[model samples]
Target: MSWRGKRKVEKPKSEEETSSNKNPKLESSDDSDNLFVCEISKNRRVAVRSWQGNPVVDIREFYVKDGKQLPGKKGISLSMEQWNILRKHMDEIDEAVAENS
Candidate 1:
């Protein structure tokens, strides 16, 4: 056997990386726990995420500055409990709208 110094060494691939390589758009399990943005309007959106192991919902405003839609200063982050309360009220609004329709 000749000297094997010509062999290239490579670090082991992570489980996530190997699976993702088989499918470029493969979303890992961790991605499910990530923030999901829900568009509310043309210049506004909501993001529900987990921060520091706590559930949170972020409501933010967007502005078109220099033709670039960017986040504005108007924003609020609420805990899961607060979000549940707001969601309850939103359900009432949904009921009213459905009744009108």
Candidate 2:
């Protein structure tokens, strides 16, 4: 038996990755989780995520300016209606933050 045959290599993928990739774009669990992440800088970042089984929302901002994790503002739970209202004002909120900085 010659060992010169081209061997097919298969890359291992996690269950989460497989599920997300197999599902339709709109049906992705991550999208439904009400999670959003944005990079503010090389080390600064912001994330918005929903609480378990609730419409409650949370926002966190952090950074790693110099190998250390820098702390930032954090917000807690919010009502579903309140979240909707916030979404509507997202652009304005961003602008306000930018103006403040």
Candidate 3:
């Protein structure tokens, strides 16, 4: 038997299944609870949010879905420690950007 013939192909999820599988925390309802939110661009944002009972700095891209802004997978969440470390090196980062530009 060919290896390809043994592979299992999964069917795509239905609309109802896809919608129901979305992470609730990524929904717009959570926006009101954010500590701070700044739109870096039309579809990008930076926000401080309480995640799993701890504060986190979230830098994420967003997409419009059903008239609501939803977080996209291309993003990063930094813990307080990580945020502080990044903050401390802001000058260096700025210098690097300046040099590159």
Best of the candidates, TM-score: 3
State the lDDT of candidate 1 residue by residue for 29-83, as single tens digits: 3434434345566666565555567777868776765555555678887998998
Q: Runs in model 1 with CA error above 4 Å?
A: 1-34, 50-53, 96-101
Which residue pairs of candidate 2 clash? none
Off by over 4 Å in 2: 1-34, 41-44, 55-57, 63-73, 89-101
lDDT tens readout by residue for model 2, 54-92? 645444444444454543444345677887998899999
Candidate 3 lDDT, tens digit per residue, 1-101? 31112222122234353334332233234333354345566667676677767888988777765665566778889999999999999999999999999
Model 1 residue 17 CA deviation in Å: 25
Off by over 4 Å in 3: 1-32
lDDT of all predictions: 0.55, 0.44, 0.60
State the displacement of the C-alpha of residue 73, model 1, in Å, after optimal TM-score superposition: 1.8
TM-score of 2: 0.32
Which prediction has more favorable TM-score, 1 or 3? Answer: 3
Cα RMSD to native, each candidate?
Answer: 16.2, 15.1, 13.6
Model 1, CA-based lDDT: 0.55
Reference-based TM-score of each model: 0.46, 0.32, 0.66
lDDT of 2: 0.44
User: Lowest summed-lDDT stretch of 10 residues in model 2?
Assistant: 2-11
